[model samples]
Target: MSTTVEKIKNIEDEMAKTQKNKATSFHLGQLKAKLAKLKRELLAGPTGSGGGSGGAGFDVARTGVASVGFIGFPSVGKSTLLNKLTGTHSEAADYEFTTLTTVPGVIMYKGAKIQMLDLPGIIEGAKDGKGRGKQVIAVARTCNLIFIVLDVNKPLAHKRIIEKELEGFGIRINKAPPNIVFKKKEKGGVNITNTVPLTHLDNDEIRAVMGEYRITSADIAFRCDATVDDLIDILEAPSRRYIPVVYVLNKIDSISIEELDILSRIPNAVPISSENNWNLDELLEVMWQKLNLVRVYTKPKGRLPDYEQPVVLRSSGCTVEDFCNQIHKSLVEDFKVAVVYGQSVKHQPQQVGLSHVLMDEDVITILKR
Candidate 1:
């Protein structure tokens, strides 16, 4: 075990010499800590027959991988949407309780692999441990984003029941609320009508109106380009959290062109037909843009550097120095300067300072010495 630890450290050192990336250093530290923990466990030895309850210790799951979970009432096309997004057929049906277990699938979007989990549908009394709602809630806690699917055809009462169940589950939903996807619409068309106060309508009424349009209450639009400040006004007037909510007016194949145009006009409303495979790509692109992601490519030297692969960073209008700091703390500390190359200019190395803002496709080499 000690030899193995030494070997790991040597490998990390070699990597540090070759590539100056912050993520690599952080990962190396994690590896060292894990190795230390294993050594300690081994040294402790034979606690109730050399392994304890299960007879063998298992590794805890590592976090930090971004994941999204599908959550909503039963029979809201959660499974169908998951299949469409991830191409992992997780059994879709028209009836309630079709999804008995949590299904996980991965979809590649904007050059990143995103894990999407389809959790069991939430029902009434879920928070109080009725209808196995607690189990569903447990599955949701791991997700970075929740896709709250709502049945437009279902009664508003049922929709309220589901929302209450979610509140009862006590999941720390983001300030940016989960995206809403409406399902199961008839052939005619759904109307926007008006963006009413959530407090004015009971759950049943909300469900009725949304069902007519095949959307969730969250999908209703407010003018255009509604910023966070504008959302705060909407939420305060009605007294709700100001979270960014996107509406997907799904089942477009069944709707009319005029209705589709109406949906397009609605702020952040995307019309998609997952069954006929329409507008899914556009929907994904829109989601990515809303998430505010910027792509940075790591040069493909002889061998693809595992730790230094292309990274997607949260865009904040920062310069190349900011990017370097995000990549690794050591690189920032030892930062002498950087040389720019590739894409925008010829491979002629241009010396740059820490304040140099990077453009897309600007290949950079750091001179750590």
Candidate 2:
């Protein structure tokens, strides 16, 4: 029996050879679905390897309100940057693969504790279980932000390779979930409704992808011009994570001014020299923006809001209830109402209930019943 990787390659080869048209749409869709499933299996750990997410030694205790993982090819200054940023040492060296395991550190920025992880170097085929790449990327998946460290002297194409490896492992960097809604029913046949014109995919291809997942009865709605792969991604929603990523182009000191200018133009990329500590502050600023954390200041009953120590929450779950729960387990149940003052509220110091959404720099004082 061929291995998962081999099977995937065969499907890919077939896909490359098969032309996309009305006649081959179904075949191509099936190939894409099969390719995606096989890739998932490969990332789940090649057949009989016990299918673990990562190595025992690589899993470190996550700290702070947010975490950032450093991933790159060998000797890309990940350790040096981590040491400089967080004042923690991780045994940096000139040779490749100097860092063998995950090194954890912390940085307190603007009163928010952010965890930094220095991971080992990963080579090509890392997604295929080559040289701890999967383990390194597995750590990255849990990070609130990812720093794709690259040596300024190396080929720029390395960025694309690293991104491909991450994507193969189901990490969608700086991407939102597709605007496709799906529901399954007992007996209704697969019905696809499109609010917009279906430009990237047609009904035949959609049906083919749905068929691969063995979905006979479902209601599918598309609000965007999504491709067949996007539909497959929605089907594989449990395995997908849409996370933010910031590309850290390391070793800028080795390059000239012109090169630095060109590097700076890349979207979502920040260039810095970990060795000289150049542009690190800018990198941190970009990281802060990408994390999108909301800080809520607690105001005592009759006093002012606490500015020294504010509760940091992710923007995705920032709400009055989430704020109370972050404070104490019973704060929500003991809550009668909350007085809020900030951009999240319209009036000054308005009384809001548990479900009220909170925003950054919002001041809140709770009254218990």
Candidate 3:
């Protein structure tokens, strides 16, 4: 176990010392592929004694429509945020290592129940199997959103370190999957195509990465300008998760208005004071948007729409049929058509088929044959 980690560290050290250029592109690509494989193995736990987190993962039986994981160093007020947002009790203190395991909470926002988990504190070398970092980040990989809680007094380096930790674990925060497409072929040799000129990737780099992965035959198409890292991410897509993240700058009451204004300038950042309960509403609003959850009201025939508990659905697969499936699996079998009376419809009450995609807050009334 220690030897694998040592190999990873050595490869990373070599990668850092080597400069990137036309001459070193192939070597760098190989090193990156090697590093990725070693890290994957470390997490896989070949010992079969439960790798990464040791026993079982800290993951709970997930509830609610979406889950948000809170990750930060100890005493960054993550537990406080979890308590305030979810009204679930999580032991909070000014000291480090206060929150040991995953403490779950539930946030009722905009008719959607979002689960929030206060994960164990993360250290600088957590990604490299330092501390309980693997366990903490393993749970984070399953979250729909992540709250990277930061102390207002902490240096910007803390934020960078946490980001690197997540990056190493194949968590791409606040990013979409790369536009590059990869396809496997049996007979044809590797064929590459790019619609746009790639500035950060060369032929050698691409070939080197694929070769290291033992991908001898594949069709590669790049829709946008891509880099070697982007190609690597594409290849590591199975292990990767593209999740939305919000930088939660806590203890904002200790900072002045001038400092608050400057902190707010950071992209996708929300400043809040969990103790003082300052700016929590704004934080919730931002969380709702980032979650991208759709709140759909189910209106029974000849009755008002039930606005209390919406049939919440994710934005990616929120069609009339999907909505019906959420209510009951048999609803689809008994389906005829749907009457949508919201942003998804043209008239006050327009009849839509099961394939019609629903927008947020859309009122849906399914009719059975």
Candidate 4:
């Protein structure tokens, strides 16, 4: 039996040689699904692995609410940025692979304790279990946000290569999951339906992917103009993560004015000189927006709202109950209405229940029963 990497290469080679057209749609879809499964198996296998958070010395006590991971080719100023921004020093050097483990740091940005990780620099073919790249990428997968730190002087293709590596490890950077509802049932017989016209996918391709996974019964509802890859992503949802990424173009002080202008044009990219601490404010601002964090102020009974330290919550689940639970586990069980005052509520100081969602800078006073 060939190694998993060799098997993956074979499938990829076959896929590359196969012509993509309506005549070969089913074959291509099946091949794609097989390729996806092989990659997933490769990541899950014990090939010098890091069990998610990180392996061995690389793991750190996860501090803060959300984590931001630094990933890129070696010596891209990840350590320098981590040290400068958070005042926590990681090893920095002139040579490559200076940082060998995950250096954890924290910064209080907009009242949210955002954890920043200076991860070990990953080389090309990282996803194929090369060196300690597997563990590095595994840590990155768990991050809420990833910073693709790149040397401004390096070739732009570096960005593409990093993206490809992350994608291979089932990290969907800066992309949302497909708006397709896919559910597996015992005897539904693979029903496929669509709300909008799908220009990139057909029933044949969908059936082929499902067949490759041995999924005989499923209900797939497509709400967007999805592609075959989107279908595969939905099928491989367990391993996939939809993460937001910001391309950090480092060493901009060495680049020309025109070159800096060009690098700024890249969407979701921030160009800065980490050594000189230039344009870092903009980077943090952009990071704040991408984080989508909400700050809720606590207004004690018959007292003014506390602005010194607001309770931080992510927009994904920023409910009154979540706020209560964050402060104290027993607070939610009191079962009282919460008085709120902020943009989230329609009126000033409106009374809401535990289920009411909180917003940024919202003032809340939990009234006991």
**lDDT scores in order:** 0.54, 0.88, 0.88, 0.89
Error of 4 at 247 (Å): 0.6
| Off by more than 4 A, model 1 | 1-65, 152-245, 256-267, 299-309, 314-334, 339-363
**Tens digit per residue, CA lDDT, model 3, 1-369:** 459889988998899899888899999999988888887777766664223342354858789999999999999999988888778899999899999889888878888888898999999988778898988998898899999999988837889999999998889989899999999899688999999999889999988998999999999999988888889889877788899999999998888899888888989999999998988999999989998889899899999999998989987557888898888999999999999988877898999898999999888888999
Model 3 segments more than 4 A misplaced = 47-57
lDDT of 2 by residue, 1-369 (tens): 999888988998999999899999988998899898888888776453423456877989878999999999988889999999999989999998789999999999988999999999999998887888888888888888999998878747899899899888888989999999999999879888999998889888988898888989999999999999899999988778888988898988888999889888989989988899888899999998899999999999989789999999977557789998888979988899999999988899899999898888889999999
Q: Compose the digit string of candidate 1's lDDT tens values, residues 138-166.
A: 55644455666644333245545755555
Question: Candidate 3: which pairs clash?
Answer: none
How many residue pairs collide in each prediction? 7, 0, 0, 0
Return the clash pairs for model 4, or none: none
Error of 4 at 139 (Å): 0.6
Report how far residue 79 has shifted in candidate 3, in Å.
1.2
Q: How many Å off is the CA of 328 in candidate 3?
A: 1.3
Best by lDDT: 4
Structure candidate 1, residue pairs in collision: 22-327, 22-328, 46-50, 152-211, 156-203, 156-204, 157-204
lDDT of 4: 0.89
Residue-level lDDT for 13 in candidate 1: 69
TM-score, structure 2 vs. true: 0.96
Instruction: Please give each candidate's TM-score.
Output: 0.51, 0.96, 0.95, 0.97
Ranking by lDDT: 4, 2, 3, 1
